[model samples]
Target: MSNHEDDVVSALKRGADGYLLKDMEPEDLLKALHQAAAGQMVLSETLTPILAASLRENRPSADRDIQQLTPRERDILKLIAQGLPNKLIARRLTITESTVKVHVKHLLKKMKLKSRVEAAVWVLQGKNG
Candidate 1:
């Protein structure tokens, strides 16, 4: 029965993995619980559109912004999006760890992102356009 968007968002931020309405069917609740237990985020159907709209509204201009990245920067970003640490990324790319850090710093600055997690989420969300 909860309809407050802020409440739902707050619960999610506090590590609530699933957000189902009280009125959902028993079978649906069971299904959601199973999904959540499997490490999936389960939002009630009614909340999906709201979340989609929020994502769209907050999404950056990734097409143009991504174009600003150098080829090497883009490679590093793709690896970062894969959840690789700087050291692993450096080893994979055959670059020094310090060089990887420099590239990450410059790319984050150019993309107006503050952290590797944000970069990973941005790319995983297909915000690269």
Candidate 2:
């Protein structure tokens, strides 16, 4: 039940581990809670970019306008670059096979890539282009 962006930003900046609307499904909320308790921060996916943008605002050069990627997406891209299949990437990332497909879709869109091979090439090119 927190919508004040500044307050939300502050909590995140202070390293609060979990942020979710009260209306989230019980299963999803529990998952986030577990992740937080494990000392890993769990942010609402919608809030991720806000956090990224705020950090970028504070450190412009270091941020460099790079496409903000979820940790999963980054991991998938690395494996894709390494020529792994979706099933294998799923196993490595510890996510369901279907979730891996979703990550692949988002990665392709975010990276402006058309296929896994294109993504692999982009990574191989050191993400310069």
TM per model?
Answer: 0.56, 0.47
Runs of candidate 2 with Cα error greater than 4 angstroms are 1-67
Candidate 2 accuracy as TM-score: 0.47
Q: Which ten residues in a row have the lowest lDDT in candidate 1?
A: 55-64
Stretches of model 1 off by over 4 angstroms after superposition: 1-59, 62-64
lDDT of 1 at 20: 86
Cα deviation in Å at residue 62, candidate 2? 15
lDDT of 1 at 42: 64
Give one digit per residue, the lDDT tens place, for model 1 in 12-123.
5454545789888899999977866654446687875554454456645543379899999999999877657677888899999999999988998898765664565567
lDDT of 2 at 64: 21
lDDT of 1: 0.72
lDDT scores for all predictions?
0.72, 0.63
Worst 10 residues of 2 by lDDT: 57-66
